[model samples]
Target: MQAEAQLAKSAILEVALQLAEKSSWDRIHLFDVAREMGVGLADIHRHFRNKDALAEAWFDLADAALLRLAQTPGWQQVPQKQRLQFAYSAWLDALAGHRRLTREMIGYRLQPEHVHLQVRGVLRISDTVQWIREVAMLPAAGWRREGAETVLTTIFLAVFARWLVDESPGTRKTQVLLGRLLVAADLGARLVAGLSLRSPASLRAFN
Candidate 1:
């Protein structure tokens, strides 16, 4: 009895995702989810306010996955770039099974008429990037912290854009792109900090 009661939001999310896989987010109704779960509509409401909340709940799964990485063995000992890649890959892999459905959910909410949802999307990106930073243990401060967040957000979006259509084994193609982007961002940041790319003798030859 306790186990069944615990299903609540998580169970509702699973059923909705399964239904969505066969059909779509638009076609699935609260009553359908209740019927599928053999519970009443009120039971579903006890967990989720509406169908859209289920999509948010789905993303929460990825967030939870990313957080778990912090507790992984040697997580804190790893270099920043490697930790970033592992953390980001874990977040994406959580949605790998439902990539198409996840994309559809975003599209449904991104309609021009749904300005509120679009705004929420921006917040979601910010929150995810912040979470990734925390998990990777980046210790940047003030302007440096802000700059790091901006670069991380840009890298995340670029990697995510590639990941959406990536069909490579274990998403190796996306990982390759992610590694290249991180290196490029590092080099760009170094150059901006006035670090010379050429050796001192090379500069002397140009002089």
Candidate 2:
């Protein structure tokens, strides 16, 4: 029964992606997704409350895949910075086939009228960065933790924006941008560590 439910949800999301590519995410209705999947609107509702929920589910799918990748032996042995670079690369590769739809969805979510979506976007990025921190065995609490999430989220957004227009073969441009961002992140992490060690009271103050 769980498998059947998962299949139904996947079908709805697949149809929604196709619709978003054909039209605009703003114009995509649950009814259209249902019709495309040959299911009742209520069926899609049973899986996702609304378009925003469906969009979030899409991100959740990517998150799940990333977690799986992070668990692989190849990922387990990488340096902290390299682990992040690998994860980000894998994430963008996952969405490569859906680039156009993803780009359009980002634009739609960024509009002033979609303030809620913008908030959700930040939350989603925070969640993903938190997961990366865990997998990389980084600090899990305090100001440093929060600061790392902020930096990683900023890097992700910058890379994502560039990726939308990046035309270099094999996404070399995106990879270069990610590499540079990770380098900066490493420096930031080192600086934060130094501060934390030198002034434990300052760390507590921020926390």
Q: Judged by TM-score, which candidate is best?
A: 1
Compose the digit string of candidate 2's lDDT tens values, residues 73-163. 7765565666777777777887787787778778888899999889988878888877766665554376666777788778888998899
Best by lDDT: 1
1-207 in candidate 1: lDDT tens per residue? 667755677778888889988998768788999999898999998888887788888888999999999999887678776888888898999999899888888888888898988888789989999999889887667776788889899989889888888889888999999889888876766565555655342111011
Local distance difference test values of all predictions, in order: 0.82, 0.76
TM-score of each: 0.88, 0.85
Model 2 TM-score, 2 decimals: 0.85
| Lowest summed lDDT window (length 10), candidate 1 | 198-207
